[model samples]
Target: MMIKPLLLAGALSIGLLSGCATDANRVPEITYEAAANSPFVATNYRAADALISQFRASPDGGPLIVATVVNIDALDQSSTLGRLISEQVSARFSQRGWAMVEMKFRSAVYMKRGEGELILTREIGEVARLNKAQAVILGSYGVSGTVVFINMKIVQPGSNIVVAAYDYVLPYNNEIRSMLVRSTR
Candidate 1:
């Protein structure tokens, strides 16, 4: 009787797993890109573009402070994979018209407000007076299965309140690189 129950459970487990493993719900892979243009990846790229635009248009902003990484705990920035991906992201930020600043070290490359400051997208000591900035962007890049996910948010300085943001997942590998290299305009 115990053997019969065990076999039944085993069969049921296999069925449940098989149901989940079907191709109908498989996630695709993603690749790194210098551009943000593609139908497959447009959703994410558009979101990022819009946020950047909003910050640029905001006159109440001080200096445009762009951040590269903020949620470091959720990512493995020390890993070789992390380093490569981070580099790619940094390059892309510049391609999109974001001013590159230093990382961690506060200097003229970054714009400042009180104790808080901007890094990456602006070199240390670069001068831009600030009553406020157009925006500050902080984001994350990660690999999910074959998919590469880039999540980011735009926030108002001083208050540190989020103004706009995005969470995008892209499939890496071939068949998508073309969409990832469009110039930021």
Candidate 2:
């Protein structure tokens, strides 16, 4: 009788411990925020608007287009991040009445062959003139740790002079990376 009761008690204890283990070590659940509504994009849009305001107030302001937005991460200007930012910034600039230049021609002029880097050799102005744009918006962003530094400028095509410029810093996170990598849907 004693052995039967001891065995029963041991089995009960084992079942209780197993139940406790399941409840004690649950997997953590994480939900990432959306990229479109992220602080990074919001801050960049505001900076772009500010730069546009300054560009409009400048003497060489009419008929502008976003030429390029480069990602200086590893000095790569054609990265997914670069393209995403360029597309969004171009859209925003277009909404504000700035024209959109064809990327093929712009890339042919600015993007170095085989390196995928932007190299604006004094020929930038000539290319802009050919495109018939008075000014071109150039943008670049760099990531350091959990912060991203973004800079944008409106440059006079022929003189290569910056007529307007703006810079802003954003707190980087996974959502921002997702924004850079994924397309807007």
Best by TM-score: 2
TM-score for each model: 0.41, 0.65
Alpha-carbon local distance difference test for all models: 0.49, 0.66
What is the per-residue lDDT of model 2 for residues 34-138, given as tens digits with 9 covering 90 to 100?
534555556656876787788745323445656445665544444455565656667777776666675555544655543232435366677667667787777
lDDT at 136 for candidate 1?
Answer: 60
Model 1: runs farther than 4 Å from truth?
Answer: 1-47, 53-60, 70-134, 174-185
Candidate achieving the largest lDDT: 2
Error of 1 at 156 (Å): 1.7
